[model samples]
Target chain A: MKLSKWALALGIFTSVALLAGCGSGSSNSSDGVTTVKVAWRATGKGDSMYRIYSKKWIADFEKKNPKIKISLQPINASEGDYFSKLDLAMKSADTTPDIVNEDTFILPADAKAGYLEPLDSYVAKWSDWDKFTAALKKGSQGSDGKQYGIPGTTDARGIWTDLVVTKKAGLAADWAPKSWADILTAAKKIKQTQPNVIPFAMGVSTTNGESVSMQTFEQLLYGTGETLYNEKTKKWNVNSKGILATLNFINQIYNKDKTGPSLSVVMSSNYGSTIFQDRIPKNQVGMAMDGIWNTGNWSKDGAAPIANMTKVLAFNLMPTEKGQKPGYVTMAGGWSWALPKNSKNKKAAWTVMKAMNTKQLAVTRALQEGTLTVRDDAAKDPEYLKKPFIKEATQALQNAHFRPKNDLYPKVSIAIQQMVESVAAGRKSPSDAAAKYATDVKGIVGDSNTDTQK
Target chain B: MDASNVIKNKPHKTQQQKTERRLSVWLMLPSMILLLIFFLTPMILTVVFSLTNLSLTGEAASSLHFIGFQNYLQMFKDPALATSIWNTIVFVLFSAVIGQCFFGFLIAFMMRGKNKTFRRIIGLIIIAAWVTPEVVVGFCWVAFLGDNGTLNMLAHNLLGMKPVAWLYTFPMVSIIIANVWRGTAFSMMVFQTALDDIPQEVEEAAVMDGATRWQLVTRITIPMVKGTIATNIMLVTLQTLGVFSLIYTMTGGGPENATSTLPVFMYKQAFVSYQLGYGTAISLVLLLIGALASLLYMKILKVKI
Candidate 1:
């Protein structure tokens, strides 16, 4: 009886192990046709249209290239999860997708990791490459001066204002603030007159991620007559007067004057959604330092419809500290298509990328996703120019600044976000936060890679 | 002539004993191999990675360098690590030690004299939380506790009070409650089974000896179930120490590292920051803590050998 029981247990264990092994069975065909795997972030409120466009692009590419099969791998996740999942997949050759839709900010780090293939050779041969302007072309190049990705869609950030609130504050209907003081004055007036409505919306917490850094902090920092990175020295400007001034400005808005939203609202994870989707359309918020894609939440096809949004809303270039050199400040960020180095079907993947990068697809994607076009031709397209807000946003791009393209940029950006949050929460004075930020950033990116600005 | 026959028989008897010992080892081989593959191998690999500079991307991706003790040294300097360790301890203490064990035992005691139908209904109700996926539980709590969530709406309408962002104001407490809700079911069932197994004669003798209900429970019932309590606490503490999905979904370790427990910290370091070596070191610390908890529980229970 003991022998029979042992045999039965061992038999069951072996069968279970065999079944588990069978569960991972994948069909690998040695057929003539090449299958190119493409992965992209297709989950979110705004990504549905992009998903449809991507599918159509894949279908068109497969049709044009009969020998290559396109597999659409839509990542149903948030931005953070998508990047981690893609990063994991790219670590191994067996699971890495051939073509990946990468955020432009991550290009330098991803490329340095040897996950990306330099596409300079392909871009040189492709005639349509010239359709992208110098700035757009620069967005795709890595720190090593190698073009490793194809820019698809980019967006610029600026000041968005509700004309109704501006008028109520005795500011002009066409309220274009020429300097930092002017913006503050307008906000103060709005607070005094319209006590119930929040005068401005700006994110600063770690939960806000790049939204706080890019839309609010960077805009303010750049306007204070300094840049975060010294381009010539290739070192981060950690201890800069510009950064301190920006922190003070945040402290002013959030803690001192209380013109911005309450700490509870700003600290929440849904601060962005609450600001744009609920507050802006409902006219509960006045001025906001935000991206150009706010209209996507309130358009006729949007999740919520706001009647006559264009008539009620207006936007302008976020002004410099005193409207000094370069006059106004805006920041542009976007996504790109990168070819992974581990991909087997490089040629087929390039074909798919090329098919997706056409002017028509770019324009359609920009229109549906409510992003600024990276291609010069697509930006000037009549259909795209029909939207007045897009025209102003395109104009705002003339003074736009890109983030510091470095491997340690992500860590540095988080430090900046923390600094802003500390000031916003009244936990630290601007000088204190600035000092701590300098120390923290120097710790993250070695001291040798950073410089103290005079 | 008799001695020579005995020596020859002894050699045959020794041969039979040797064969039986060899068969016993063979019978244990499968379990030993499975443990080695599933648990021991990964643990050894984590230790190896912890001694090096290994990251998912950037410089550490293509090249790995052995920087012995460097990852652990850096972890000591990381301010977030201190906060994460404190948060982890608080989580385990509240969620497992006090919340689950005390509340679970309380409910078990309340239902001790109940009928079968009442017991089954209460069991199903509590087990519902235990059986629900962590992610679903997290989402449910988020909806019920968010700023504009169900609780806040109800409070606003009923009390004429301001809405509270419970997760923001008290992230640790909120997560502890959610965890207790999910885990108390296990403790409840275990304690109930243990209570039932106690001999009826001992309890009846105590009752006949003029012992009050409270005295009987304190002096007799708790002492009898001390072993089960220790086991339940050990299991729940270890399980709660590694809760990532529920906490991550609820708060994402923010407003500003307020809710970043060890597992969340490890995840951010390993996946988000791509620092695999540093994250592995944190994982080893977590494993050591779990091992220490088990040992401490065993010692407290005075379980010999």
Candidate 2:
């Protein structure tokens, strides 16, 4: 009896083990078509736009080529966390996605790290390569002179001011500052006229981190003709005269209390969604140094629809230091679609990337999402040109510059942020803060490798 | 004749005994192997990685030279690391020791004979806060305490005052409040169970000897639950030492790294700065801190077990 029972148990265990094996093996090979996984940012599960577009695009591509399948894995984390998680996942070959949506700041870093594959071979064969602007193309080039990713869209930073608030301060309805002094004077006037309303808003807290460094500090620095790193010399510039001046300007704005929101209010990530979605629409803020995409949140499909956005709001070019030639300056950066170095199905991934960068797809995405296209054809398309904000932002982009793409940009940016925060907090004089920043940057980049242009 | 009988008996018993012992060891082997592979291997890898300059930047180092104590030396030189370590120490002392334990014990002591319904409701409320997602909790706190947030709105509209930036001015304090609110329930639950396990007879005997409620708690109840308190302190200290989400979501370790603990700093280095080696080194230091804390607690408790 015991021997028969043991035999029965062994037979059952073997059958169960075989069934498990079959279940695991079913997902491995399916009809000889490899499944390529692609990851991108989506707002949430409730947003059907991404889902619908992805499904239709996949179906169309599959019909054209029946031997490949693409699986879309949409990530819903915030921008920062999404990038961190994506990097973590991409660390291993087995778990890496075939394609990824990368931010402009990270693309160069990832390319330098060998996380991305050089797409020069593919770009050479691609017909649409010539359609991309030279500057936009340069944005995707790594230090090794190889193209790593294809730029999808770019945007410029500008002043988003409330016309009503400007008028309340006796400023012009079409108020546009031609110089840094003009901006400060107007801000002071607004503060005096409407003590209740915040006169100016710029992000300058560590919580805001790179956003503060880019959108606020770099916007000012670039206008002053100061760049974070000198590409020619391949060294970081922390002690530039323009940087000190920019620091002083930030210090005056915050210490003098002539700005829109408090340091804390300006630093919060929700500052964008909340100020634009709730506060600015409610007429609480006078001016915001924000991206061109603010109008996207106030259109008919926006989170808070402002019927009179064009009339009530005004867009202005961010002014250069003294309103010199190239009167107004702006900084532009864009996100790209990159292929992981370890992607199993490179051809299929390349097809999806090509589809994503097509003129039609780019225009549709730009129009639907208010992104500025990197491709010349898409940029000049009637669909994009018809959008008023797009036209204005595109004109502004002519003088736009990008952040120095360096592996140490994130650290350098953090140092810049700390100095900005110190100035905003009234804890240090601008010159002192600038000196400290130079020292800090020198420490990070090493003395031999750094050059501070004073 | 005796020697022959003894040899025969030993041969007869050998196969059965050997089979039984083999089966028993085989039954325990799988679990032992799992513990060694999963738990021990990763820990050893972490230690090894901590000593190397293995960053995510994908640069091939000229050499993987073992520079003994170099990473730790660099940790001391990093301003952010020093600030984070200070913040961690202060946070542990304030939030865990004073906020969670002391206040938790006080509430539990008061509710010892209070209405059961009140106790249950309070317990559920505290647990609810503890169980809420860290991100949601961070958002709620930011909404309540931020500039132009609910608190500022109330201060201006209802109290007729100027708005104050709670998050910017008092970032560490704001996060400490949030951490304390979320973590106090754990201490409460621990103390509650420890109190329940205390013998009623001991308390009754103290009462009969004319001991007051405070005296009974001080002398008898506290001593009985001392071990639980020690364990709770060790656990919560380690947990709080590694808390990244709350501060990241709320302040991003901002207002000049005022609220940055070691974990946040380590994460910013590893992920944001892409300095995996430096970050791993920081993590190793954090692990050492936790271990030292546990050992200190054990020594103080002097628990034989």
Best by lDDT: 1
Candidate 1: tens digits of C-alpha lDDT, residues A1-454: 4554675577567656745864555333367678888788774565544554556666776788878888878787655556778888998778899999888877888888889999999999999999987787788788898998899888888788999988988997777989988988989999999987999888887666667778888888888877888888988887778888888889889878889987657876667778888788888888988888777667776656678878988877889998897788788888899999988889888887888788987777776666888888887888888754887887888888888888777667768877887788776789988988888888888889888776
Measured against the native two-chain assembly using Cα atoms, what DockQ does each of the candidate structures obtain, in the order listed?
A: 0.35, 0.35
Model 2, range B17-133, lDDT digits (tens) per residue? 765565555444555555676789888887887777766553412134456666778788877787898999998888887788887787777777678899999899989989998
lDDT of 2 at A429: 86
- For model 2, the stretches where C-alpha displacement exceeds 4 angstroms are A1-29, A43-54, A207-209, A425-432, B1-24, B58-70, B115-118, B147-161
lDDT of 1 at B37: 71
Runs with alpha carbons beyond 4 Å of true place in candidate 1: A1-29, A45-57, A168-170, A188-196, A262-265, A305-307, A425-429, B1-34
Q: After superposition, how far is residue A169 of candidate 1 from its true place, in Å?
A: 4.4
DockQ-based class of model 2: acceptable
Kindly report which residue pairs in candidate 1 clash with one another.
Answer: none
